[model samples]
Target: MAGTLHFHPNNLFAPCITNLFWFKLHHHVMVQFKKYVESFPVKPLFIVFTVLFFITPSAIASVQISRTQILMGDVPVTLVVKTAKKHTIKVTRAMEETFLLGKKLSDSLSEFSSASDISRINRSPSHVWISLKEPLSLFLLEKSVKASNLTEGAFDITFSSSNKHTSWADLAIDKHHQRVMKKAAGLKLGVSGIAKGLIVELMSHHLTKKGFDRNLVNAGGDVYASGTWIVGIRNPFSPEQKPLTKIKVKNKSVSTSGLYQRGSHIIDPHTHQALGKKEAPLWASVTTIGNEGPMTDALTTGFFLLPFHKIESIVQQNTGFKVILITLKKQVIKISH
Candidate 1:
């Protein structure tokens, strides 16, 4: 517990330790406080403990929701949000709304799933336009297009679930009607690279608009914090042990795309396959921190597909983004803000 909140002042334990456990302890403390109430010299520490334990400014609520099913791969989806208990209803409602939005976005982007916007487009006949209709779908498509362009097709979304024929160059958007068209008849899209971050963004925005401060939204491993939050980076080699590093972030999105979380080379869009020990050594795991979830999410995947030397231009152009690369040899590469 030395490295825990006992030393860190983030009020982490206040939310994690349940009131039921503290209440039982509170009863014993009250007994001791009463015994020392009349005799101040007897146990002054008991009164202090009782006050700190029971009379907190307010309760903090941390909730984790299990999504009905797994997402892209066999990776199960979980949504977590933390906030002050006083606004429990608001936070819960915000989470509910966010999850619904996530489902819609997932169905639209998942190439593995059929009957979605992407699947329908792929299933469509050649040169036929499929209507995106929904504004959110159009927005996500736009972001994916931009990500592909920004990464020079490294972060392409045109990866089909069942075929390898489609690519970034085959996509086209009609802004006048808010629709997207695929030049290749069987083109499919997968936005899992950036969708996780968008979910975090939406959840954070909804929570913030609901008047909650000190809130955090973590969808699986993608995270965004509106206030000071201590986030842990997963250990690539060891999953059962503690996190490799803990960083405090505020008003930022923290995204880690690697084989550690997905049990495969999730960051590699080109191969759509896991990397071997001798393959892509430096990009074994990539962690990027930024203000936007989409940007952080996009960079983690796009940069992982490129060589370390090739990533210099991206970081040099972006002012606030920071990246940490853990090589296959266990060497650490840090790019400062």
Candidate 2:
């Protein structure tokens, strides 16, 4: 019978043929090795069996595991780690510890929690110094304060207060003393916008300390990638939820603040209100990549509120920062420094 042959690399039949060829080659080699061993005074047959039984599978197989859950009450957190099968238990244990660490940090920073340090700051009387006991809380607050300055008040933690005159400027932060005081009464501050990124960054650091060579920590739209990872940006207008683009990042954080992710949820600190269609920028989504997750997260939110020219200026000022702007009309613009 005449038969047609298919040998395309992408086809299933090609793999079968390749496996058969390798099997025959291996069999022939083994037969020759046996004959040679018979001629030798002593044979090392156990060495060959050990290589086939122990090392072959280990060399061919690797393991990847992931965990996804809603962290910090509402934010979605995902952890992905890759390693050899032999270290599966170690990686899993590291992931569990990382999750616990994230939860503890979230609880400490949560403004809704009466026991939280932030909530205590909100409840404190004006002009009274409150010593921050937790090191993590102090660090986060210091970072938030710095972010306000970096973004020119566009990334203020106190942006949500009903009092328009009260802002981050009204708060006195003493990082050296580990204390803070609100100069204006009812000047409530919340780090919900930037806290997720901070948590993810710390989680990534913990995983690295645990000896995970390849890992990723994603909290909502904020992400930190260790080693190399390809992350996808979602198409906001796609009904089928396709990726708008993909970017490879190594030891960096990529954050996206978009209308698609939250739908007019970003409040303009300047106006003390949600960004209306008219008030919003021409870009529907603003993504920023940087070495620090919190900064990238803050930049994305700040860029979304600022004009395009202003955003370009900020991107230029920051070294090693990259911005991707997706316009309302679906045009993509990139700015890198």
Candidate 3:
């Protein structure tokens, strides 16, 4: 991304300060005296000075520059910054590197550490317990499992090729020792859901440290914004659908869960069945905004299973978050901060 800034020196500082310290000091006094003179000024001198001050620096100091792309998360990511071009580029590069490393760490721990990988680790049960090479992924998985339990199993990480029951909670994380153990055989872990958010958070922190005033990190659909950004909540029912509304977001995360994508991927853990039928009016899509991505992910999943009345309570409990639920009938309900 590239941008330009036109700086008018007259708007910022006096024009005659371009030379030596003493000359600049004399220029400041003269400008102050000129301002006082202008208060009772002859019109011609006032007009001439004003035009010189305003136009000169604008022509001299206007800047134009381009920003380079920085790859982040599991893919390449780029964001536009309107201020501090050089610093923004450096920050973006650092964040990109951080996100790439974080993804590598997450992939090593979970993606390659599946049941198939475990089968190759060893053939013995007594020594089956293993310590992950990367512990942050393990921490993210722990948080996901806890969220799953809290949301009454609406958000689950477990899936089986044979269509059987496998719970992530059954796996134990020894945080002190940085190890994990499975209670039963055939239990596997996948960190796909929560890893994106972790990567976004990491990048956001990196950019903030580098003094970029505003930035956004979007991993597929999961997004984190450091400063003000506009979001469009999609309308679920329309064939020619548009975003139901525009929302202002800052330093927050937004996640949208819907039946439109990967139909029935989310199953209610308690019943071990997809959410198909319900007693109350349900939305086709639900978009949730919150301080953390994992929480937003969990809440969006849970909200899909809840009645409209229940959603109010959920929003109330998590006060800082906002929610927009788009029904199958094309109706929109907004819960705002």
Candidate 4:
């Protein structure tokens, strides 16, 4: 196998600073064999075949074939493509496509950008159907609505709205027309909780469609693994920021939400206020692993704001979901179906 790892030196989210590294032990071995055979005189034809047979397999075996690349932005993204070295061209194209898709999704969902789809939707006249340009935006909105329903309003995108009456229920979605209307005034959608995971999902899907079925896409703390991956749960309270534990998952998504990640960014939908202030948060971090990236992301945020029993009940109801809760006291609790 052959592999390349790329990273930006200034990227704070990258694990290492190496810009690019090529691992081609097989190539090195072939070069060494050519020099050895040229310097020796013994049955050249038979010796050449014998050396090639032994070295070819060893060279291929030593080559690290996976391609791992990092993209730095508001949220750091890591894309891993697992394929044979012969498919380098395909892997390059797949990475480019996935990166472009991720950028588009981020731009469309960014509330800070006035020209973004979310911002345009927010500024649109209330109760009037506004046509959507980017189909990705509409897809995210539909998923947002489903997430709100799944979490029983605990993961509402309308939590950012200042209007007391505004909620996810007031948003009317016309999927056939690719339009939406919010009945309540001042209803603004804040989809940061699930947008990253959507980005991960779409990027992973694009790679898989391009024949790279064994891949991993991680945006911030939201991750989607197409094959088996061993992911670690970070210890938020630890000064060294070590992993408290690790778990192996197959074809699943994992997302972690906590005050440690963004410092009280999560809001309680019911109270319409930032969490972890009035009362100490029950858990320091909530890590959720599930079959769907968006849902896992939403659940991580939702579980952080819910009580233990409520979280447990929700997890039990969803067979595909499991959660790892790290308490303020540093205790780890694992819940699963």
**Clash pairs (backbone) in predicted model 4:** 1-63, 2-64, 2-65, 3-64
Off by over 4 Å in 1: 1-85, 112-115, 161-166, 263-273, 277-281
Q: Candidate 3: deviation at residue 313, Å?
A: 3.6
**What tens-digit string does per-residue lDDT give for candidate 2 at 123-241?**
88899999987887787877787777867888888987757899888989888989999999879988887878888999999999999969999887899999999988878677257
Models 1 onward score TM values of 0.71, 0.83, 0.67, 0.77
Per-residue lDDT of 157-246 in model 1, one digit per residue for the tens? 765445566677777788787666767665666677787787667767775776665567666667888888788887788767887777
Question: Can you write out model 3's per-residue Cα lDDT over 157-215, one digit (the tens) per residue?
Answer: 65431235657566676778776666666564545555556666666666667666477
Q: Which residue pairs show backbone clashes in model 3?
A: none
Candidate 1 pairs with clashing backbones: none
Ranking by TM-score: 2, 4, 1, 3
The local distance difference test score of model 1 is: 0.68
Better of 2 and 3 by TM-score: 2
Candidate 4 stretches greater than 4 Å from native: 1-59, 62-73, 86-93, 239-241
Highest TM-score: which candidate?
Answer: 2
lDDT of every model, 2 decimals: 0.68, 0.82, 0.62, 0.79
Worst 10 residues of 2 by lDDT: 9-18
Point to the candidate with the largest lDDT. 2
**Better model by lDDT: candidate 1 vs candidate 2:** 2
